[model samples]
Target chain A: FFQISPAPSYANPGIMQETISVNDVKDAHKNWCNALLAISKAHSEGGLAKSKPLASEIIDAAYAYQFGPVAFKPTWAYGKKTFRTTKDGALSYFIGDNPKFNDPGFGIGSPGNKDYPNLKNRSPWVKCTPENFAIQIFGNTAIGMGWVHFEAADGYKSKVDKTLSYIRDDEGNLRITVHHSSTPYSW
Target chain B: FFQISPAPSYANPGIMQETISVNDVKDAHKNWCNALLAISKAHSEGGLAKSKPLASEIIDAAYAYQFGPVAFKPTWAYGKKTFRTTKDGALSYFIGDNPKFNDPGFGIGSPGNKDYPNLKNRSPWVKCTPENFAIQIFGNTAIGMGWVHFEAADGYKSKVDKTLSYIRDDEGNLRITVHHSSTPYSW
Candidate 1:
């Protein structure tokens, strides 16, 4: 037997009609970690030729670029290139080799040079672990802040303070609208 | 004549049932700027005892502390005190004078010493202007990135790179879920 009810009318328009939960935010973080590892693996196995498409796909699926400009601030980005709002800028930051932007390919890694001494011995990343210190959920949106640890194949380890805001997309998938990463500040 | 319609059901559950607009994000930024100026004015006229309650009210109205921890990284905050996730921490950053945290009362300004040379001659802020570079809208959530310039009563000026994420709350008010601010990175 089916009981039919009146069309649902929200009494409080300010309240989220479809709520996002804390578990949902955690799942989004897990998905992002897996995607990063995948990009690194693709880079190591096939180079930019192989990793570019995968990275593009991941960016399209994870970021809200189609919706509008994404607020992305990479850890090492400085000067005018600090904020990467366009999709192409995001691509350069993830895959590298773009002459326009002075990116060391943060996700893929670049050859060691005088300018990038730290990247010289680095290989593709082998691991990524997200330790979320705080998570806030509001309706279809959520924000997470914490530290993300990375281990390179060459055993080089690094960590960054990361803040991300996720929103549910048209297809019910969570997508990142804001991403800010930086090394922990010290005296 | 009365017409009866069936209950409204979302065909795409993943899509936002209620969408936020670009204008909404801009309005939120304006509200934030006004609140900052109000806090400064309150401090200039009365001091922390008078400004603290006003700051508290503004924080409660503008931020999503009621939802959960906010991902707030204030400019000039260093070491372990960088992120202010709790309402109390947020209050301290805005009104200052907390012994627990090493805040110089960023919003209210403190008497400067050898440790804070730059703050020595600084006075309460008299003006705040937001220049948004990018804005992204997703359903009931939006993210904005831009520069916020401040001018002190004594003619001192400063600016910071700011990124804020807003979500419509239970009362239909736009509230900040993520707030990250820092001095622009240079070579």
Candidate 2:
């Protein structure tokens, strides 16, 4: 027996239905990449104080956290921290410095220095590019999957497989409901 | 620089626009649950010979592997097997017994015996229930996130947090493009 009752229809008859186009999805990806770059730049210039607020704003603008908990499986998060459903968890994943999660701050990165000699040398990301292999649009919602290549200021390049599910909000803004990223499997 | 060129729209102007209701998403979930139960039953009644074909059919009918690589992250998979994009990988995840992937066969559990002395005792699942916490329907596409509970014949109960992103196919069938499952974080 199903324990969940079907939710009420989110559609409003009074509002005109606007179909989401492929360009819209691309634009959304661009916005996301730009936000990540901005956060990294902020962190490099003024540390967490500058980056944390920007990361928060980006999360608020990009994700569907307002509706409820988002399904966020970050690239490096593992074990108990694999899924980040809460806004605070999302923030910590982006900018880190949160003692509770012990995250390396994927966006900000950590430098290899005396304090953390074992940690990998990762500088703030300076370049971000999305290479979508498949994009399926279903009216107001869309799903895109492909590889996202990231480059840190130290010239280190990393790539991860990424999938993002988007739903158009009442104001025609596309918000991410599911974001899953993982490194490619190697034999 | 974005490396992806925007894909052409999939909408057909001649066809009448059909909005996907919340019930449709629930129905899709029900179909998925039923398929899992059927696979388990098949394995119990006739072993891998009987269950393998059924698993293959279910994978084809349910997943969007036709569109391209699906972003699938199974619950128990780890290391190089974490993400299953290829159809072969998906099949291996469901039925196991494939030496290439070295899967424990999540759907068809291993019994406590000499061959698998260290393996946990797990019987074929007999019941499946989905409790969706959030379902966001955007016309032809939908995303659902919740917990799915499964019960094996031995009365062992397992629950996993799941997220599924579905897009309505040309034939009016809901096909999953992104399926992510993980155990709830225990901190």
Candidate 3:
């Protein structure tokens, strides 16, 4: 009756892969943004330490995972309020004891203030929606982008152009390999 | 005697895949940046026409590719000086016949002055080097980041944080999937 369980559909692998990849990106993106909001909430309640492990879970080990080899260089290191140059430094700034925001250097510094690394402050990000979300899926790898709208706790509203690239680990989880965010430009 | 050529060495596919992906991204990035300089040169010598084809080749077809389906939304809209919101609008600003430099709006208008959209004016980019280049290779897809320094033909110099995400097509060609560039924030 069962003839070798139907060969697993390796035929049309490209099309199948694209479908899976797109869906994966969509799901991962939702989780990723939600995680940001969750971290903010946790920070507001208990402080940045509460969000450290959550942050680690979302980011790729290559970028910085305490349990993994530390190859420090975050994709989110841009703008005046940027993350630390090294993953450890960034983690420290976020959850550890360090208060040197706005370091004056090109590719080096903690552009974020010395307060809580909670992005939305005590205010929660009600909506982290993408204006023109675009995704490019390549097998188990993908990149996604769009102008992210962050509706903060208050009536405060802001948006940043966000881009992220990631790969699925062995366990089929999307780990953010690159993250870059910045406000739109104007003179 | 051949013995199936030792099974074609599929034993360490992960390691092999990483090496190939990293190399591919490096080559693509080099070509991509150099293309910017080349386009600038062409714009200076001829005009936007000279650079149009080059631009089309590097960018994802979704933005503007005559031979492919016209899917608006480019992977390379970054910073304050951006193109129009729509693809046709952006194409109009880029190689189109119109020239509306700065229209007042939050997410509308090209902050770039009416010129040959080659970025650095008539000045050739002598150097577009990265301060700290970081790359995360994910099979056929990848993302790269660094603070790029631009030295223009007029001796004007500036730096912008740049990030890009891309995937290799079936033909093994790299197409930029996302590009975001911004100046460092300051208070």
Candidate 4:
């Protein structure tokens, strides 16, 4: 019997043919972001936001697992401390805010755990990029773990092990939530 | 600049304190039965071959390349075939002759030209279990592309993109070898 979790590699854009084109990478990333955006949208609005809710649902699940379920609130910083609401009311942060989201042990060079206090204590999640290599996909889970290229407070470029987890609820959909990463100051 | 490839979740094994065991899966019947063993060792070769003939010498100097500079030569297979003196004998099927050897392909997958006719064939060399994943060190002559896992056949299991190239003088002394994969497969 096939396992329960769905395979992310074969999402809407899976490798049907044996040949892997460069576009496959970009498409997969787009699919991944789309998956996340769905969830992010749901957390912001009660209206049905399409299949994207899966991503939001997973995020809520992570919050349920980490902070209390109440913490599932959605917040996106577009820039440093400078934040504003969009037409749809999604909070976007443009200013660079501490990635810890307010975790007490903000930068402890560890894959943050619930024990870290609040999301603020968590490692900052970076917007996904191509440099982050896709490592493995197990069963229905596609695990993309890589060294997030970021600058250390000391002005040095540091790579941290950033992990993103994607999963689906009872309904068939793709979602990404639950991130664990470490930075230099994380210790 | 990220000089090092990010290690997998299983890299520090210490990162995740767990005692996980896996029951082996059945194998796919491949040519010469040598690729099977190559894949096996790859499973535990700590990523890349501990040592190998410098990819430069192997590609530019290996007399084997004198014909075409093959992409996916099994490391040991290259060593043995190059000697031909019956001194350092058969370590792989490609080195030893099976009816498949005469199949008009340069090696087992000689028609490999079909997949990678231009030295860009994703799979440059092949190996069996014990070596498990096929390693292809592609640098086009730089630090070298190391440890890439491509979805391989035999039931779509991800194969380690590991393969080595070697070069020997009148007397074999591993002229210039390099190791590319800094981490192991996550799955």
Which one wins on TM-score?
Answer: 1
Model 2 lDDT per residue over A17-107, tens place: 4677888888888778899999999998999899999999999989989977787877767666667878888999998878888877878
Per-residue lDDT over A1-187 for candidate 1, one digit per residue giving the tens place of the 0 to 100 score = 1223456569623332466678878888888888888988998899889999999999999998887778888776766787888889998888877888867777784233425523555488778898887887766777888878888787778777788888787567888888888766442
| Candidate ranking (lDDT, best to worst) | 1, 2, 3, 4
Ranking by DockQ: 1, 3, 2, 4
Error of 3 at A25 (Å): 1.9
lDDT (10s digit) by residue, model 4, range B64-88: 3342222232322221122121111
**What lDDT tens digits, residue by residue, belong to model 3 across residues A1-187?**
0112333556633322222366676776677657667656665566545666755544433332432332222334445435344554555433444454422211112223424243222355556676545666666666666666667666566667766656666555666666666666544
Top candidate when judged by DockQ against the true structure: 1
Q: Which pairs, if any, clash in model 1?
A: A7-B7, A14-B172, A112-A120, A172-B14
Q: Compose the digit string of candidate 2's lDDT tens values, residues B10-65.
A: 66233455666788889888888899899888988998999999999999999989
Tell me how far the alpha carbon of residue B42 in candidate 4 is from the true structure, in angstroms, after superposition.
Answer: 21
Go through the candidates in order and give each one's C-alpha lDDT: 0.77, 0.76, 0.50, 0.28
| Deviation of model 3 at A99, angstroms | 4.5
Worst 10 residues of 1 chain A by lDDT: A109-118
Q: Give lDDT for model 3.
A: 0.50
RMSD of each: 7.6, 11.3, 8.0, 21.2
Interface RMSD of each candidate, angstroms, one decimal: 2.7, 6.4, 6.4, 20.3
